[model samples]
Target: MATADPRLRSRAQQQQPAPVAPPPPPPPPAETTPAMGLDGSGDAPESSGTSSDDSFKLKFCTVCASNQNRSMEAHLQLATAQLPTISFGTGSLVRLPGPTINQPNVYNFNSTTYEAIHKELADQNTQLYTQNGLLNMIGRNLNIKKYPERFQDWMPGKPRLDHKGDQGYHGTESGVVDVIFTCEERCFDAVLEDLHNKGGRMNRPVHVLNVDIKDNHEEARVGGQAILDLALSLNNAASEERKARGETGWDRGSGGARQGFDEKVPEIVAAWQERWPTLPALWSLAWF
Candidate 1:
């Protein structure tokens, strides 16, 4: 009003109060905690996408030539650890080849008794298997489980043809397994081929991995331990994935879950195989 200088008037205008800065976004709602179960587990809340009665236990299938040595060993190890598992043979029929070529003794995995096989082998030539350490391994297998009935015949496409019918271990429907660990490269190839040829018909996803171990007692022992380690690693990884996806349990029907598993499988198999670098083995992975 007193005809103040133009500079002074500009200063007065600049001194007026500035607008507030939008209250800093309300601190992002405190990053809401993930839904939880009544038992206090950090699982997603009950919903159609989640199940409270879900079984967290993973079902495994071990495949080797005859399901007698390598697969059986891993099967027993899994059983001892109280994991749900089943064993299979890549062969159309269970046939244990003897030390001599063309001397395989064929038997049905579902019906033949290990004891009878052992006795027969012993009677034929105790020294044949005894000296080669097969008898000892067979004996150990018998002691590990109640009977040879623990072994079941399985191919990739068909449901496990067991005497007990199609009910696979751990209540798996149609003999579907979350993962199948093969002991040798050939068996691994067989599984992949079977899956390729018939996987489209499968209702659930299956992961096939090869560890490529020698088919012997000591090797079987080593392979079994390795398989157990891999199984645990996979289970842990899968759990973390479910949590990240906000899933309360494994959704077998979810293609996303299966894809996630398939994505991580190569890395997991490579890491596990790296531990036994000196072993003459071919490690590979495939899923369908």
Candidate 2:
């Protein structure tokens, strides 16, 4: 029932006051859908870029068995988006197809430069390597970086320096990444296993994800686009995540800030999978 207006209230009733309707029930608190953390240690990483950075990007590292086909393609796409990125190979050495099915040209992953491989392959047989697409792959790699780097040998927290002594493309000087995208399952396993062996020393959480793309130039290109799309989705979420958490940086007294990003990861990937059904993905929460 409505109460009488104050203007019409009798003198005594006005002095007594009218009954006040309870304030409409406080609007229900916002729906906060929390994503699970990869681990329950409740510790944040010590590295500079793993958790938060000055820019919108969560730095990216792309990995593949050879680092020639899929990883490089993804790296190119990520860097093209102005995202800080690096690429690595999981194999013992860089291998390229040679004259026969049984024979493969091999080079030290860390020491062999793309120019050296391209020149040597060209010297061996330009027409054959061209027909095989090795030359074209090498040329593409040359524009991206100096050589194939082995993930096993990557020194965590060390600034990225190319063979030419310049800082890595877009300055990976932070020596840390917020996410890793492996081109296939084996490479994803290698990355996780390597991280496991290294232990979670950084205390920061890094998302390791896999997009299974075949090892071919054309497939790599298609996968690169897909990877870029995923990166963008994750990047935008990260920005919102940071905003929601305010400036808490990844470490609140009770570790509440981390949920900002971790909670959104699975949802984001699932949505991305819908758009790119051809490229199946696997995700894990790992550390630096």
Candidate 3:
């Protein structure tokens, strides 16, 4: 073979060095890596205080036929049960948007009974106005003055029902409510239909409990007691459930804890029936 030029030989030798691949491009900025700049297993997952299942709030709407005796009684009873996280209100016009009927006699009935109850409570020094903590009591324990400011003007015996078709009941915008209690089948049907059609705060699921009041005394005494009993028992179950689950909120000790209506309502209903036999004929539990 012919001898190669020294310069050419040197060039060939330099070129002969094996090809070397550039280092693999730095791994794409690991998007999965947490912002803390630590690799996997380095950081904790985001922690929101509330449980994922507990995202929704619980609300109760006590709707009744007249909103006078039966429904009003139920509302008062439910209010007193004082479940920690629930909100309560009573009236034919509260959630309704349109005008409501007026009972000229309502002022007479609601005022007289309310004042009598208020005066009695005042003597006991448990007057609602005097004691902020006792405002939610109803029926035998009701404090008219301590009634919520929104309900301050409500007359107990007064006809809460506006006979004129001008009135309507509507739930608020706070959020979806879990339950609705109505006294009597007619009332339950009407209220449910209204909620189904004209929806808002009540846009969520609801449960209806009807009360039967065939007679005036039963309407007044048994009706009130049954409603109250239902509320108290239901709330109590919720409290127990919450306690078991380690939930923290208001009125935990006093049976005021929010509960899943579906989970606790059946037991509550059974408990209520056991407490008051008359309650069975009037009540129907439904969910929507």
TM-score for each candidate, following the candidate numbering: 0.65, 0.77, 0.42
184-248, model 2: which lDDT tens digit per residue? 88787777777766665666677888999988766877787788888888888877877766646
Q: Write the per-residue lDDT of candidate 1 for residues 131-181, one digit (tens) a residue.
A: 665565555444433234322224434454443321124444355567888
Which regions in candidate 2 have their CA more than 4 angstroms from the true location? 1-55, 161-168, 250-257
Measured by TM-score, the strongest candidate is 2
1 or 3, greater by TM-score: 1
Any runs in candidate 1 off by more than 4 Å, and if so which? 1-55, 97-102, 143-168, 171-174, 248-251, 255-258, 279-288
Order the numbered candidates by TM-score, best leading.
2, 1, 3
Residues 95-189, candidate 3, lDDT per residue (tens digit)?
Answer: 21111234122222233333343344344343322333211222222221212212223222233233221111122233234555655555544
For model 2, give the 10-residue run with minimal summed lDDT.
33-42
Q: Candidate 2 local accuracy as lDDT?
A: 0.69
Return the top candidate by lDDT.
Answer: 2
**Per-residue lDDT of 25 in model 2:** 14
TM-score quality measure for candidate 2:
0.77
For every model shown, the clashing-pair count is 0, 4, 14
